[model samples]
Target chain A: GIQVEQSPPDLILQEGANSTLRCNFSDSVNNLQWFHQNPWGQLINLFYIPSGTKQNGRLSATTVATERYSLLYISSSQTTDSGVYFCAVDTQEGGAQKLVFGQGTRLTINP
Target chain B: GAGVSQSPRYKVAKRGQDVALRCDPISGHVSLFWYQQALGQGPEFLTYFQNEAQLDKSGLPSDRFFAERPEGSVSTLKIQRTQQEDSAVYLCASSLGGRGRRETQYFGPGTRLLVL
Candidate 1:
Protein backbone atom coordinates (compact mmCIF):
# COMPACT_ATOMS: atom_id res chain seq x y z
CA GLY A 1 0.00 0.00 0.00
CA ILE A 2 1.31 3.41 -0.93
CA GLN A 3 1.20 6.28 1.54
CA VAL A 4 0.23 9.84 0.54
CA GLU A 5 1.09 12.81 2.70
CA GLN A 6 -0.12 16.39 2.22
CA SER A 7 1.78 19.34 3.64
CA PRO A 8 0.56 22.32 5.67
CA PRO A 9 -2.50 20.53 6.95
CA ASP A 10 -4.07 23.96 7.35
CA LEU A 11 -3.71 27.15 5.32
CA ILE A 12 -5.23 30.62 5.47
CA LEU A 13 -4.64 33.44 3.06
CA GLN A 14 -6.07 36.75 1.84
CA GLU A 15 -8.36 36.72 -1.18
CA GLY A 16 -5.64 38.02 -3.50
CA ALA A 17 -2.78 35.93 -2.16
CA ASN A 18 -1.19 32.82 -3.60
CA SER A 19 -0.50 29.43 -2.06
CA THR A 20 1.03 26.09 -2.84
CA LEU A 21 0.12 22.66 -1.50
CA ARG A 22 2.41 19.68 -1.81
CA CYS A 23 1.75 15.96 -1.81
CA ASN A 24 4.45 13.32 -1.37
CA PHE A 25 3.85 9.66 -2.02
CA SER A 26 5.87 6.79 -0.64
CA ASP A 27 5.84 4.80 -3.88
CA SER A 28 5.35 5.20 -7.60
CA VAL A 29 1.84 5.88 -8.87
CA ASN A 30 0.15 5.46 -12.23
CA ASN A 31 -2.49 8.16 -11.79
CA LEU A 32 -2.76 11.30 -9.67
CA GLN A 33 -5.74 13.62 -9.08
CA TRP A 34 -6.51 16.75 -7.13
CA PHE A 35 -9.94 17.54 -5.70
CA HIS A 36 -11.67 20.26 -3.77
CA GLN A 37 -14.27 19.21 -1.24
CA ASN A 38 -16.65 22.11 -0.85
CA PRO A 39 -18.59 22.91 2.30
CA TRP A 40 -21.46 20.89 0.90
CA GLY A 41 -19.19 17.83 0.62
CA GLN A 42 -18.98 17.53 -3.14
CA LEU A 43 -15.62 16.27 -4.37
CA ILE A 44 -14.88 18.50 -7.34
CA ASN A 45 -12.12 17.17 -9.57
CA LEU A 46 -9.43 19.76 -10.10
CA PHE A 47 -6.73 18.05 -12.08
CA TYR A 48 -5.77 14.63 -13.37
CA ILE A 49 -2.07 15.10 -13.78
CA PRO A 50 0.03 11.97 -13.44
CA SER A 51 3.04 13.89 -14.71
CA GLY A 52 4.00 17.25 -16.17
CA THR A 53 2.07 20.45 -15.54
CA LYS A 54 -1.50 21.65 -16.17
CA GLN A 55 -3.28 24.88 -15.49
CA ASN A 56 -7.00 25.34 -15.00
CA GLY A 57 -7.95 28.96 -14.45
CA ARG A 58 -6.46 30.12 -11.14
CA LEU A 59 -5.48 26.58 -10.19
CA SER A 60 -2.50 24.67 -11.53
CA ALA A 61 -0.80 21.39 -10.65
CA THR A 62 2.56 19.78 -11.37
CA THR A 63 3.50 16.21 -10.68
CA VAL A 64 7.12 15.13 -10.70
CA ALA A 65 6.62 11.43 -10.89
CA THR A 66 10.36 10.78 -10.76
CA GLU A 67 10.53 12.48 -7.36
CA ARG A 68 7.33 10.88 -6.06
CA TYR A 69 5.81 14.27 -5.28
CA SER A 70 3.25 16.73 -6.69
CA LEU A 71 2.54 20.41 -6.22
CA LEU A 72 -0.75 22.36 -6.44
CA TYR A 73 -0.69 26.11 -6.86
CA ILE A 74 -3.56 28.57 -6.46
CA SER A 75 -3.14 32.11 -7.74
CA SER A 76 -5.16 35.10 -6.58
CA SER A 77 -7.24 32.87 -4.41
CA GLN A 78 -10.92 33.58 -4.09
CA THR A 79 -13.07 33.25 -1.01
CA THR A 80 -15.04 30.52 -2.74
CA ASP A 81 -11.94 28.35 -2.68
CA SER A 82 -12.31 27.80 1.04
CA GLY A 83 -12.57 24.09 1.58
CA VAL A 84 -10.51 20.92 1.82
CA TYR A 85 -8.07 20.15 -0.97
CA PHE A 86 -7.24 16.49 -1.44
CA CYS A 87 -4.46 14.72 -3.36
CA ALA A 88 -5.21 11.19 -4.40
CA VAL A 89 -3.14 8.65 -6.36
CA ASP A 90 -3.77 5.28 -7.86
CA THR A 91 -1.20 2.56 -7.26
CA GLN A 92 -3.23 0.24 -9.56
CA GLU A 93 -2.87 -2.72 -7.19
CA GLY A 94 -3.78 -5.94 -8.95
CA GLY A 95 -5.25 -3.67 -11.64
CA ALA A 96 -8.01 -2.51 -9.26
CA GLN A 97 -7.24 1.18 -9.83
CA LYS A 98 -8.43 2.35 -6.43
CA LEU A 99 -7.37 5.81 -5.32
CA VAL A 100 -5.39 6.41 -2.14
CA PHE A 101 -6.01 9.88 -0.72
CA GLY A 102 -3.91 12.04 1.54
CA GLN A 103 -5.09 13.56 4.81
CA GLY A 104 -5.98 16.72 2.80
CA THR A 105 -5.14 20.39 3.22
CA ARG A 106 -7.83 22.66 4.65
CA LEU A 107 -7.67 25.99 2.90
CA THR A 108 -9.34 29.18 4.06
CA ILE A 109 -9.53 32.45 2.17
CA ASN A 110 -10.53 35.72 3.77
CA PRO A 111 -12.63 38.01 1.63
CA GLY B 1 -24.39 14.43 -19.30
CA ALA B 2 -25.18 13.93 -15.67
CA GLY B 3 -22.49 12.80 -13.23
CA VAL B 4 -22.73 10.05 -10.68
CA SER B 5 -25.72 10.34 -8.37
CA GLN B 6 -26.40 8.78 -4.96
CA SER B 7 -29.68 8.19 -3.26
CA PRO B 8 -30.78 9.18 0.26
CA ARG B 9 -27.88 11.61 0.70
CA TYR B 10 -27.94 10.82 4.43
CA LYS B 11 -28.89 7.85 6.57
CA VAL B 12 -29.26 7.09 10.24
CA ALA B 13 -29.11 3.54 11.54
CA LYS B 14 -29.11 1.94 14.93
CA ARG B 15 -26.57 -0.59 16.08
CA GLY B 16 -27.26 -4.04 14.74
CA GLN B 17 -29.42 -2.67 11.97
CA ASP B 18 -28.69 -3.31 8.32
CA VAL B 19 -28.23 -0.41 5.88
CA ALA B 20 -27.90 -0.24 2.15
CA LEU B 21 -26.52 2.57 0.00
CA ARG B 22 -27.13 2.97 -3.68
CA CYS B 23 -24.89 4.43 -6.36
CA ASP B 24 -25.90 5.33 -9.90
CA PRO B 25 -22.80 5.83 -11.95
CA ILE B 26 -22.67 7.71 -15.23
CA SER B 27 -24.22 5.81 -18.09
CA GLY B 28 -21.76 3.56 -19.94
CA HIS B 29 -19.05 3.81 -17.31
CA VAL B 30 -17.29 0.48 -17.06
CA SER B 31 -15.73 0.82 -13.63
CA LEU B 32 -17.35 1.63 -10.30
CA PHE B 33 -15.80 1.99 -6.85
CA TRP B 34 -16.87 2.48 -3.25
CA TYR B 35 -14.97 4.36 -0.59
CA GLN B 36 -15.41 5.30 3.07
CA GLN B 37 -14.28 8.53 4.65
CA ALA B 38 -14.25 8.96 8.39
CA LEU B 39 -14.45 12.30 10.13
CA GLY B 40 -11.33 14.35 9.48
CA GLN B 41 -9.73 11.64 7.37
CA GLY B 42 -9.25 10.86 3.71
CA PRO B 43 -11.47 8.40 1.89
CA GLU B 44 -10.41 4.71 1.90
CA PHE B 45 -11.23 2.19 -0.76
CA LEU B 46 -13.85 -0.38 0.18
CA THR B 47 -14.57 -2.28 -3.00
CA TYR B 48 -14.33 -2.09 -6.78
CA PHE B 49 -16.28 -3.52 -9.68
CA GLN B 50 -15.29 -3.79 -13.30
CA ASN B 51 -18.62 -4.14 -15.02
CA GLU B 52 -20.74 -6.86 -13.40
CA ALA B 53 -17.70 -8.64 -12.06
CA GLN B 54 -16.17 -7.60 -8.78
CA LEU B 55 -12.43 -7.84 -9.32
CA ASP B 56 -11.14 -6.51 -6.00
CA LYS B 57 -12.61 -6.20 -2.54
CA SER B 58 -9.49 -6.49 -0.39
CA GLY B 59 -10.12 -3.05 1.05
CA LEU B 60 -13.32 -4.15 2.76
CA PRO B 61 -12.82 -3.86 6.50
CA SER B 62 -14.74 -6.98 7.35
CA ASP B 63 -17.09 -9.63 6.09
CA ARG B 64 -20.02 -7.52 7.18
CA PHE B 65 -19.42 -5.15 4.30
CA PHE B 66 -20.76 -6.30 0.96
CA ALA B 67 -21.00 -4.66 -2.49
CA GLU B 68 -22.45 -5.75 -5.79
CA ARG B 69 -23.13 -4.55 -9.30
CA PRO B 70 -25.45 -7.02 -10.98
CA GLU B 71 -26.08 -5.26 -14.31
CA GLY B 72 -22.86 -3.20 -14.26
CA SER B 73 -24.54 0.20 -14.23
CA VAL B 74 -25.91 0.71 -10.75
CA SER B 75 -24.32 -0.70 -7.58
CA THR B 76 -25.26 -1.18 -3.99
CA LEU B 77 -23.21 -1.44 -0.79
CA LYS B 78 -24.76 -3.15 2.18
CA ILE B 79 -23.52 -3.33 5.75
CA GLN B 80 -24.95 -5.96 8.05
CA ARG B 81 -25.30 -5.40 11.78
CA THR B 82 -23.88 -1.95 11.59
CA GLN B 83 -21.79 -0.69 14.50
CA GLN B 84 -20.92 2.78 15.73
CA GLU B 85 -17.64 2.63 13.89
CA ASP B 86 -19.57 2.22 10.65
CA SER B 87 -20.44 5.91 10.75
CA ALA B 88 -18.76 7.59 7.84
CA VAL B 89 -19.34 9.18 4.46
CA TYR B 90 -19.72 6.58 1.72
CA LEU B 91 -18.54 7.76 -1.68
CA CYS B 92 -19.24 6.30 -5.10
CA ALA B 93 -16.99 6.93 -8.08
CA SER B 94 -17.13 5.88 -11.71
CA SER B 95 -14.57 5.87 -14.50
CA LEU B 96 -15.05 5.46 -18.24
CA GLY B 97 -12.47 2.70 -18.62
CA GLY B 98 -11.84 -0.72 -17.16
CA ARG B 99 -8.89 -1.94 -15.13
CA GLY B 100 -5.32 -0.69 -15.96
CA ARG B 101 -6.42 2.45 -17.79
CA ARG B 102 -5.62 5.95 -16.59
CA GLU B 103 -9.05 7.56 -16.52
CA THR B 104 -10.49 10.35 -14.46
CA GLN B 105 -13.03 9.23 -11.89
CA TYR B 106 -16.13 11.31 -11.25
CA PHE B 107 -17.55 11.15 -7.74
CA GLY B 108 -21.09 11.56 -6.60
CA PRO B 109 -22.32 13.45 -3.59
CA GLY B 110 -21.53 10.86 -0.93
CA THR B 111 -24.06 9.35 1.42
CA ARG B 112 -23.35 10.21 5.02
CA LEU B 113 -24.22 7.32 7.32
CA LEU B 114 -24.48 7.70 11.04
CA VAL B 115 -24.80 4.54 13.15
CA LEU B 116 -26.00 5.16 16.62
Candidate 2:
Protein backbone atom coordinates (compact mmCIF):
# COMPACT_ATOMS: atom_id res chain seq x y z
CA GLY A 1 0.00 0.00 0.00
CA ILE A 2 2.87 2.31 -0.73
CA GLN A 3 3.30 3.95 -4.05
CA VAL A 4 3.75 7.62 -4.85
CA GLU A 5 5.17 9.04 -8.01
CA GLN A 6 5.16 12.69 -8.93
CA SER A 7 7.37 14.09 -11.60
CA PRO A 8 6.77 17.00 -13.91
CA PRO A 9 3.16 15.98 -14.43
CA ASP A 10 2.97 19.57 -15.60
CA LEU A 11 5.06 22.61 -15.01
CA ILE A 12 5.49 26.01 -16.60
CA LEU A 13 7.83 28.47 -15.04
CA GLN A 14 8.98 31.89 -16.17
CA GLU A 15 9.15 34.41 -13.41
CA GLY A 16 12.74 34.01 -12.35
CA ALA A 17 12.71 30.41 -13.56
CA ASN A 18 14.32 27.51 -11.76
CA SER A 19 12.52 24.35 -10.92
CA THR A 20 13.13 20.72 -10.17
CA LEU A 21 10.31 18.74 -8.68
CA ARG A 22 10.27 15.04 -8.19
CA CYS A 23 9.18 12.50 -5.65
CA ASN A 24 9.25 8.78 -5.90
CA PHE A 25 8.53 6.25 -3.26
CA SER A 26 7.57 2.63 -3.17
CA ASP A 27 8.41 1.49 0.30
CA SER A 28 10.33 2.00 3.51
CA VAL A 29 9.15 5.18 5.13
CA ASN A 30 7.49 6.13 8.32
CA ASN A 31 6.54 9.52 6.99
CA LEU A 32 7.55 12.03 4.38
CA GLN A 33 5.85 15.26 3.48
CA TRP A 34 6.05 18.25 1.19
CA PHE A 35 2.82 19.87 0.23
CA HIS A 36 1.64 23.16 -1.13
CA GLN A 37 -1.78 23.18 -2.65
CA ASN A 38 -2.18 26.90 -2.60
CA PRO A 39 -4.39 28.93 -4.91
CA TRP A 40 -6.96 29.03 -2.14
CA GLY A 41 -6.94 25.28 -1.53
CA GLN A 42 -4.43 25.73 1.26
CA LEU A 43 -2.70 22.45 2.11
CA ILE A 44 0.59 24.18 2.62
CA ASN A 45 3.39 22.51 4.56
CA LEU A 46 6.51 22.68 2.50
CA PHE A 47 8.92 20.11 3.75
CA TYR A 48 9.09 17.38 6.31
CA ILE A 49 11.91 15.59 4.48
CA PRO A 50 11.68 12.23 6.22
CA SER A 51 15.31 11.77 5.43
CA GLY A 52 17.78 14.38 4.29
CA THR A 53 18.21 17.99 3.23
CA LYS A 54 15.73 20.80 3.65
CA GLN A 55 15.54 24.52 3.15
CA ASN A 56 12.68 26.91 3.29
CA GLY A 57 13.50 30.15 1.55
CA ARG A 58 14.18 29.65 -2.08
CA LEU A 59 12.44 26.38 -1.32
CA SER A 60 14.61 23.33 -1.29
CA ALA A 61 14.28 19.70 -0.35
CA THR A 62 16.16 16.51 -0.88
CA THR A 63 15.44 13.14 0.58
CA VAL A 64 17.50 10.32 -0.76
CA ALA A 65 16.12 7.81 1.68
CA THR A 66 18.24 5.08 0.20
CA GLU A 67 17.27 5.96 -3.35
CA ARG A 68 13.56 6.17 -2.82
CA TYR A 69 13.99 9.60 -4.39
CA SER A 70 12.66 13.02 -3.42
CA LEU A 71 13.81 16.37 -4.63
CA LEU A 72 12.10 19.71 -4.76
CA TYR A 73 13.89 22.91 -5.46
CA ILE A 74 12.30 26.07 -6.69
CA SER A 75 14.97 28.71 -6.84
CA SER A 76 13.93 32.23 -7.76
CA SER A 77 10.42 31.36 -8.77
CA GLN A 78 7.61 33.64 -7.80
CA THR A 79 4.10 34.34 -8.98
CA THR A 80 3.05 32.95 -5.64
CA ASP A 81 4.61 29.70 -6.80
CA SER A 82 1.41 28.75 -8.54
CA GLY A 83 -0.36 25.66 -7.20
CA VAL A 84 -0.31 21.94 -6.49
CA TYR A 85 2.97 20.41 -5.40
CA PHE A 86 2.46 17.52 -3.08
CA CYS A 87 4.45 14.41 -2.28
CA ALA A 88 3.31 12.60 0.77
CA VAL A 89 4.20 9.16 2.02
CA ASP A 90 3.84 6.97 5.04
CA THR A 91 4.55 3.42 4.03
CA GLN A 92 3.35 2.26 7.41
CA GLU A 93 6.87 1.86 8.62
CA GLY A 94 5.79 3.24 11.93
CA GLY A 95 2.09 2.88 11.28
CA ALA A 96 -0.70 5.29 12.29
CA GLN A 97 -0.45 8.34 10.08
CA LYS A 98 -1.55 6.94 6.81
CA LEU A 99 -0.66 9.17 3.90
CA VAL A 100 0.27 8.26 0.37
CA PHE A 101 -0.33 11.05 -2.06
CA GLY A 102 1.45 11.82 -5.27
CA GLN A 103 -0.42 13.00 -8.29
CA GLY A 104 0.74 16.56 -8.14
CA THR A 105 3.41 18.85 -9.51
CA ARG A 106 1.17 21.18 -11.41
CA LEU A 107 3.05 24.43 -11.06
CA THR A 108 2.64 27.29 -13.44
CA ILE A 109 4.19 30.62 -12.68
CA ASN A 110 4.33 32.74 -15.76
CA PRO A 111 4.78 36.36 -14.95
CA GLY B 1 -7.21 27.77 15.92
CA ALA B 2 -3.81 28.32 14.46
CA GLY B 3 -4.48 25.87 11.66
CA VAL B 4 -6.50 22.80 10.73
CA SER B 5 -9.92 24.37 10.54
CA GLN B 6 -12.51 22.98 8.21
CA SER B 7 -16.21 23.44 8.05
CA PRO B 8 -18.90 24.43 5.61
CA ARG B 9 -16.32 25.89 3.30
CA TYR B 10 -18.50 24.59 0.52
CA LYS B 11 -21.09 21.90 0.14
CA VAL B 12 -23.86 21.33 -2.35
CA ALA B 13 -25.64 18.06 -2.01
CA LYS B 14 -28.62 16.71 -3.88
CA ARG B 15 -28.02 13.19 -5.06
CA GLY B 16 -29.34 11.55 -1.94
CA GLN B 17 -28.70 14.27 0.58
CA ASP B 18 -27.50 13.57 4.11
CA VAL B 19 -24.09 15.12 4.52
CA ALA B 20 -22.13 16.41 7.45
CA LEU B 21 -18.50 17.42 7.28
CA ARG B 22 -16.64 19.36 9.92
CA CYS B 23 -13.26 19.29 11.56
CA ASP B 24 -11.38 21.61 13.85
CA PRO B 25 -8.11 20.33 15.18
CA ILE B 26 -4.77 21.82 16.14
CA SER B 27 -5.42 22.62 19.77
CA GLY B 28 -3.45 20.08 21.69
CA HIS B 29 -4.08 17.74 18.83
CA VAL B 30 -3.63 14.04 19.37
CA SER B 31 -3.85 12.67 15.92
CA LEU B 32 -6.90 13.15 13.75
CA PHE B 33 -7.14 12.67 10.05
CA TRP B 34 -9.66 12.15 7.30
CA TYR B 35 -8.85 12.88 3.72
CA GLN B 36 -10.51 12.26 0.38
CA GLN B 37 -9.73 14.64 -2.40
CA ALA B 38 -10.51 13.73 -5.95
CA LEU B 39 -10.22 16.46 -8.53
CA GLY B 40 -6.72 15.96 -9.65
CA GLN B 41 -5.87 13.33 -7.07
CA GLY B 42 -3.81 13.32 -3.88
CA PRO B 43 -5.17 13.07 -0.32
CA GLU B 44 -7.03 9.76 0.18
CA PHE B 45 -6.95 8.10 3.55
CA LEU B 46 -10.49 8.27 4.96
CA THR B 47 -10.14 8.05 8.71
CA TYR B 48 -7.93 7.81 11.75
CA PHE B 49 -8.19 9.25 15.21
CA GLN B 50 -6.28 8.67 18.40
CA ASN B 51 -7.88 10.89 20.98
CA GLU B 52 -11.43 9.64 20.82
CA ALA B 53 -10.33 6.35 19.41
CA GLN B 54 -11.36 5.41 15.84
CA LEU B 55 -8.14 3.75 14.99
CA ASP B 56 -8.74 3.81 11.27
CA LYS B 57 -11.60 3.27 8.97
CA SER B 58 -9.40 1.64 6.35
CA GLY B 59 -9.95 4.37 3.81
CA LEU B 60 -13.72 4.02 4.06
CA PRO B 61 -15.26 3.93 0.65
CA SER B 62 -18.48 2.07 1.11
CA ASP B 63 -20.96 1.99 3.96
CA ARG B 64 -21.88 5.52 2.93
CA PHE B 65 -18.82 6.85 4.70
CA PHE B 66 -18.92 8.01 8.31
CA ALA B 67 -16.53 9.35 10.93
CA GLU B 68 -16.62 10.96 14.34
CA ARG B 69 -14.33 12.17 17.08
CA PRO B 70 -16.73 12.64 19.98
CA GLU B 71 -14.95 14.35 22.92
CA GLY B 72 -11.46 14.28 21.51
CA SER B 73 -11.63 17.75 20.06
CA VAL B 74 -14.03 18.04 17.14
CA SER B 75 -14.52 16.03 14.04
CA THR B 76 -17.33 14.73 11.95
CA LEU B 77 -17.67 13.28 8.48
CA LYS B 78 -20.90 11.68 7.62
CA ILE B 79 -21.95 11.05 4.08
CA GLN B 80 -25.06 9.03 4.27
CA ARG B 81 -27.14 8.34 1.17
CA THR B 82 -25.04 10.70 -0.89
CA GLN B 83 -23.86 9.55 -4.29
CA GLN B 84 -22.47 11.04 -7.48
CA GLU B 85 -19.17 9.59 -6.55
CA ASP B 86 -19.52 11.77 -3.46
CA SER B 87 -18.04 14.70 -5.35
CA ALA B 88 -14.61 15.69 -4.11
CA VAL B 89 -12.41 17.66 -1.72
CA TYR B 90 -12.80 16.81 1.96
CA LEU B 91 -9.63 16.93 3.95
CA CYS B 92 -8.86 17.47 7.63
CA ALA B 93 -5.62 16.54 9.28
CA SER B 94 -4.00 17.06 12.65
CA SER B 95 -0.95 15.70 14.40
CA LEU B 96 1.32 16.44 17.34
CA GLY B 97 0.55 13.21 19.06
CA GLY B 98 2.56 12.13 22.07
CA ARG B 99 5.50 12.68 19.72
CA GLY B 100 5.95 9.10 18.73
CA ARG B 101 4.51 7.31 15.73
CA ARG B 102 5.31 10.44 13.74
CA GLU B 103 4.19 14.05 13.74
CA THR B 104 3.54 16.99 11.42
CA GLN B 105 0.12 16.61 9.86
CA TYR B 106 -1.71 19.93 10.16
CA PHE B 107 -3.89 20.40 7.16
CA GLY B 108 -7.31 21.95 6.73
CA PRO B 109 -8.84 24.23 4.19
CA GLY B 110 -10.86 21.74 2.35
CA THR B 111 -14.46 20.59 2.29
CA ARG B 112 -15.68 21.27 -1.18
CA LEU B 113 -18.37 18.69 -1.63
CA LEU B 114 -20.80 18.72 -4.49
CA VAL B 115 -23.00 15.77 -5.19
CA LEU B 116 -25.72 16.50 -7.62
Top candidate by TM-score: 1
Off by over 4 Å in 1: none
After superposition, candidate 2 runs with Cα above 4 Å error: A1-14, A17-29, A35-49, A53-60, A63-72, A78-80, A84-91, A94-97, A100-110, B1-12, B18-34, B37-44, B47-63, B66-79, B83-112
lDDT of 1 at A93: 50
Cα lDDT of model 1 by residue, A1-111, tens digit: 799999999999999999999999999999999999999889999999999999999999999999999999999999999999999999875598899999999999999
TM-score of chain B in each prediction: 0.98, 0.32
What is the DockQ of the complex in model 1? 0.79
- State the weakest 10-residue window (summed lDDT) of model 2 chain A: A90-99
Chain A TM per candidate, in order of listing? 0.97, 0.33
Docking class of 2: acceptable
Q: What are the TM-scores, per candidate, against the unseen true structure?
A: 0.98, 0.34
The best candidate in terms of lDDT: 1
Best candidate, DockQ-wise?
Answer: 1
TM-score of chain B of 2: 0.32
lDDT of each: 0.96, 0.89
